[model samples]
Target: MDCILHTERLTKEFKGFVAVDKVDLRVRRGDIHALIGPNGAGKTTCFNLLTKFLTPTSGRIVFNGHEITHDTPARIAERGVIRSFQISAVFPHMTVLENVRVALQKKLATSFHFWKPERSLDGLNARAIELLREVDLAPYAHLTTVELSYGRKRALEIATTLAMEPELMLLDEPTQGMGSEDVDRIRQLIKRVSAGRTILMVEHNMSVVSSIADTITVLARGATLAEGPYAEVSKNPSVIEAYMGSASVELVGAH
Candidate 1:
């Protein structure tokens, strides 16, 4: 399979501590790759590095055959790599349709033009509504974001991310803080969105990872402890030891 994202010896250091040690990561095109680890295992740090939120202390990050280790976050995003659904990314006061339309504005490079007539930007509404439908948020189009439930809020964010037409999306814990039903909904949403695109997610929920992730990478102590499908990685002694007592509990229902 062709790799959409690749990292070699990716490292991040804070003073004397290495938050993310030399790590090699590869995410295949159109694959849902999950990065899993225990607390303080540097999963998020590695995510930051991949998304260019943090410069690597040492390493190379290549996306779609271009080296982006030193690229700015905006530059990386312009290359079709986008991070989604940040809580702050949505404006609670704006209507759901307005929120998505704002995101479309970013792609149109008209986000800064407040003087433009509303009709001038009407072209974006159709595309924004299309994205809303894609994420199942079309019904809530005219509702204020604050009126939506937390789960729907996340879905709205996904719609916003889609407006960018990303080829690679970095999602950190898409199902975090959700109930079982919400988890399932988001899982299906993620699957729905992964078409023709690659997703790299840092998630802790084993069940979610098992069901949706095409590939899983386990990290321990800021290093890659294991990498493969969930079934293989789950049985690895090193991974079991890292999760210890909770491994079986967490992975019991995982296939």
Candidate 2:
């Protein structure tokens, strides 16, 4: 399979410490690839490098066939690669419709047209409403963002990312802090939204990752320890010894 994103010997050094060791990563077109590791395992650092938020100390990052190791984050986003954070990112004071409208406005490059009547902008309201519906936030469209639950904020975040029409999305713990129902909802939303797009997510919950990930990469101590399909990686002795679960809990339930 052709990789939508590929990293070769990617490494990041902060002063004398290496946060991301020489790690190679591949996310194939239209695949949901999960990156899992303990805290300080370099998952976020890897994300930073991929998104060009941080320049790598060494190695190449290829996206859609071009070397993007030196590209700016905005330039990468223009190439249809986007990432959402573990923390909620939304204008809590804005109404749900207004929040999504802002995101759509950014993608449409209409931020400078503030004087224009928002309703008159072709497809603005329609598109925002569509995205809101896509993430199951339609009913809350007119509600203030602060009125929505934490999980709804996450859904809104995903909707905002979708407005960019990304080819690949890097999600950092998309379901963090969600209740079981909310987790399941977001999992379903991810599946629904990622139909034709590739997703690389850093997830610690075995059950969540197992349910959604097409492939899994395990990192420990800032290096890739193992990688494969969920079943294979779970059974790998190295993974079992290091990342089987919190305290080697039976992974069977995860699947």
Candidate 3:
């Protein structure tokens, strides 16, 4: 299988507590892979380790066949592994278009040239608008980000992430606090954006995961409990027990 990202026994510990146990995760290229588990299952910790926010206790992370376990977060991003929401990329005061324009600045290698005339950035507007359109935010391009609805803000975030030209996008809880309508929208948005890229998201919404994820890896107590398509993983006894029965029902229902 053409894996774009994978880990070999990746582990992390804090003050004698093993947060993320040895995890062997493999994400296929052009697939929407999900990392899911109950609260405190070390999902975020695994993401931190993957993005180099927290150093791993041991094991190696390989992306596109290169070892990135020890690389800095910036270096990982430079390598085209971009994690969204770990660092908020949005500027609330900026217009939606301007926000994406700022993210596009990195590609021009002029991100720090604040003194450049406003017209210097005019060249970025067209591409920025295209990205906004991709996430259905083009209509709000002239609005300040702070004025957008919560779901729209998240959509804007996706646009900014796209501006980075990521090969592998890591999304943390893309639908965490949304109503069902918003959830479905973002779920579809995620599906739409996954066309030519690989997405590895740590998601809690089983419905969203079932609908869009090509493969699911269920984590519990810092270790993988199950890994497969939702149809298969949802039936795993251990995964059901980890959710204490209720979520298993939800998983099956979602499937």
Per-residue alpha-carbon lDDT of model 2 for 1-255, expressed as tens digits? 799999999999999999999999988898999998767889988998999889999999999999999999999999999899988999989889888888888898888986887676657888999999999999999999999988899999999999888999899999898888988998999989889889999987778888889998888888999888998888776666565455456555441
lDDT values for all models = 0.87, 0.88, 0.90
Candidates' TM-scores? 0.95, 0.94, 0.96
User: Which candidate wins on TM-score?
Assistant: 3
Clashing pairs in 1: none
Off by over 4 Å in 1: 85-88, 245-250, 253-255
Worst 10-residue lDDT window, candidate 3? 246-255
Q: How do all the candidates rank in terms of TM-score, highest first?
A: 3, 1, 2
* Stretches of model 2 off by over 4 angstroms after superposition: 117-122, 244-255
A best-first ranking of the candidates according to their lDDT comes to 3, 2, 1
Question: Of the candidates numbered 1 and 3, which has the greater lDDT value?
Answer: 3
